[model samples]
Target: MSILKDKNILLGITAGIAAYKSAHVVRLFIKAGANVKVVMTPASKDFITPLTLSTLSKNPVYSSFTDEEDDNEVWNNHVDLGLWADVFVIAPATANTMAKMANGVCDNILLATYLSAKCPVYFAPAMDLDMYKHQSTKASFKKLTAYGNKLIPAGTGELASGLVGEGRMAEPEAIVKFIENDILVQLPLYGKRVLITAGPTYEALDPVRFIGNHSSGKMGFEIAKAASNLGAEVVLVTGPTHQKIENHLVAVKPVVSAEEMYKEVHKHFKSSHIAILSAAVADYRPKNVADQKIKKKDTTFTIELEKTKDILKSLGEIKTNQFLVGFALETNNELEHAKGKLKAKNLDLIVLNSLRDKGAGFGVSTNKVTFITANNTIIENELKSKANVAKDLMELILKQTHA
Candidate 1:
């Protein structure tokens, strides 16, 4: 998959003849698997229509702070648009727009969004040769770069003024390639291998029935994606789950019973640099399973149970260079029990989830967790999407391992 896959790109279009190329830019970003939204200066519309941009991006193109036809009743929060983007790109950046950006001018929605943006900003300048070489334009470039905005240097080619010079906007294809290469090479886990287990394993009692838990496997799948985003090669040993992951770096091994999960986990564990066991494996399974479903003839039926293999504990016993992590789900004595598991499982870190916390527990997208370190230190986290929680977990893992 492209490194830009799933990325939120906010494209800003400014008034310039080169603004015509922005349609191609949006198309390329979409083709590369990025979700794109366009913001245009009012004057830019003369060169390129909002209808065309919106049609290509499949999202409303914003120019003004509110709908021009609407009264002052509606407003577009510039800060929200700024924060929603992972990266902002202003292709065909005019000298006027560049000056406004460098001077803190926010009269237009595009400039206001730029001022409020928390993500990286990239601008490609486009103008005639003399205008591009002007001292003011040069200063704007220097000032914006000093403020941490990336400037994609203009190409040398024929200008719209019927003059050949170094003021053409970089091609759409080149700009996307540049960003992809830059982002891919900076991933934190670029060379690491991660092994993860997820979902509720089923222990067969009969052909028609089995034992399982409420786990939706969302947490494990989120962790796998987060790790893959950081450039890790992941082996995900998952139990029955409706969840799916599309990252090319993650290789999923589906399993049914606890024994199957255990075997799959072990098969990839030794090759991993980090191992996280998040599967809700059964503690006890039916000692004997019938080949045929038992008829409902008896008033009461009984089946013997036996302990399943301790996968985490066994990994702890044989661990070498791997940084082992485990999870603890508790309702009572949460911290105490979590700490006990952190030590008992020989884990370098343990993430504790409390069923008592609202928005937390199995089958949900959100989680409230506490992190217990090997040194007995504790870090509590507020409720967050499981995806963000997974990000925080990976950050901790990187810190502990690299420390």
Candidate 2:
């Protein structure tokens, strides 16, 4: 999935020959799952109709401060438009608009919104080569960038004047990619590799049956999504579950048995900066496996069992600099057990969940968890959605790691 997914994008259009390309820009943003709104300079309507942009964006296009509808003037709030955007992109920014922006000109609604915007602003310059190279235009570039507005350098191409050179606005795809990369590089977890395990690992007893818990893998999947959104490259080794996620940063590896999960986790752990093991792996598996399904012949039967590999403890023993995290589900002496696991497993942090707490653990959307640090710091959190819990856990990890 594109990093632009679910983002609110405010597209600003100006009166330039390149303004025609803004339509494709809006289409691409919408294709990438962004909610788009267009703000155009009044004169820009001569180049591209607001009706076309409004149709593509599914939102009303704003060109003037007031609109006449049924003889009633409805005011368009520029401040509200600016505040609603997560990102603002001004494509085909004419030299006129560029100078206005650099000089604090706010005659147009688009300019007014730009002046009021608090989010990052990106401008793609479009003009004739001569105008682009003019001293005044260069000054505008310098001033705008100095004010922290990102500049998408004009590409070399044929202009409306039939001259081939730089000053053509970047292609729609390239603009989208540039913005996505810009957003990613500024995230806290950028360039970090995270290894996470999720779901209940099944211990096979027969082809038709297995030993597993009620764990839905919801918590772990939530964590993976949260980590990916924060710009971490995540490896999610998950057991059988119905949970699904679509993120470019998260690579999902499906496993069934505890041994399979253990192997997958280890493969990625060595190269990971952080490893969060949240899978509910069975502690034991049948010592012997029946090749065929064993039919019930008697009222009672027994099968020998043996200990499965302890993936978390193994990682803790071999961990060098990785921030290791584990989960402890306990019904009694929760704090003591979680702290003990944190120290015993050499984990940097441990999350404790008590089954006794309602709306928490397995199959549910909510969770109540307590975080225990290696130094025995205890922080209890109220019941919250699993997604929120994952975010909180990540925040705690960031604080510890950055500290």
Candidate 3:
């Protein structure tokens, strides 16, 4: 039930002495199944090293605005970072950072990224007790909140300055709960069951090899996480992945092939309010399979092809109150083909991807998609991280689910 599961949450650590506690915060998010990334303020570097945070996060630590490591000077993309995060969390926020947030200061890379962010930003302030209660500090916080940022609301306890009153940074566990609880309250699909299919289903042509895609199930896993965050009780049917499922609340059922996926999907999908078929199920399979591996490399060899069951169409016939979503991958005529599937399959919506796009389609960290509904309506967007794309998809479904 952790809110951080499969979430792309970026942690921004400022120069406060409390910066030491960010390690625990990172651990909490990681335990919640989030892909945690850290941005350390130069001052924060004094309190904690990039190596330490990087080790916990398992992602690169971002610091300088123009800093680059490789020869090409192709630096970490701050614009991409700004657009990638589902939520931006500034833990151990200092008065300097708070004041900069209030006045639009962009002195550091972290601050610059904050200025450029498009997602929800949250801050947990920490300072000396008296400094926290100052009129100036209060006003800065008020202004930042008015700009649509959220306050994680610091705790009251002993301070680093040796005086006991207020200004303690919120505990990592408490911050994790704050995020989860907030999301749980706004779940659009609350009480509604969601069934999703993810990963590449291996359609066996023979024992030695089978037709499959490079889907690691990351996208599908992300969808399940988003649905759970939005309050749906999710059932994830995944093919395979090394990544662990973040939310224990969502029931996960694993499968290996199209038939397996269909069986598991249909069993639970009967009660599901929504279904997103993101699995790369084989459209065609060998008509007959050899029991043993077909040895020898033959330049010319052919296997009879047969169509696999159309899971979406089959479900559409039995669907009553459920919403059906399909996915389309095309190299040409992308929109026309996607719209066709939306109508023919009786899908409420279809997500379209073209291999022509750089970050989209199979085996990419980022994606660019055009969401097409049953009415032939379209909502197109530029490339974004898969995390953001998943969140966007969830929001649209929520609009429909709520409506």
Best candidate, lDDT-wise? 2
- Report the lDDT tens digits of candidate 1 across residue range 1-403: 5678889999999999999999999999998799999999999999999999999999989998888877764787789899999999999899999999999998899999999999989999999999999999999999999999999989999999999999899999988977876676678887789999999999999999998899999999999988888888899999999999876789999999999988998899899999999888999999999999978988998989999999999999999999999999999999999999988889999999999999999999999999999998899999999999999999999999982
Query: Candidate 3 on 1-403: residue-level lDDT in tens?
Result: 5766677999999998888899999998998778888987887999998899999999989988655566666576677888889889999899989999999988888988898899889899999998899998999999999999989988988888789888999988888888777667666677788898888888887797888878877788888878877788899888766545757558989887788888888898778889999888888888898899988798999889898888888988888899999888899999988988888888998999898999888777788999998777799989998878889998998776662
Error of 1 at 402 (Å): 3.5
Candidate 1 structure, TM-score to reference: 0.70
TM-scores of the candidates are 0.70, 0.97, 0.59
Tens-digit lDDT track of model 2 for 45-65: 999999999999999999998
Lowest summed lDDT window (length 10), candidate 1:
177-186
The 10-residue segment of model 2 with minimum total lDDT is 65-74
Give the clashing residue pairs of candidate 2, or none.
none
Candidate 1: where are CA atoms >4 Å away?
A: 1-8, 12-21, 27-48, 58-86, 90-178, 331-333, 356-359, 382-385
Candidates sorted by lDDT, descending order? 2, 1, 3
**Could you give me the TM-score of model 3 versus the true structure?**
0.59
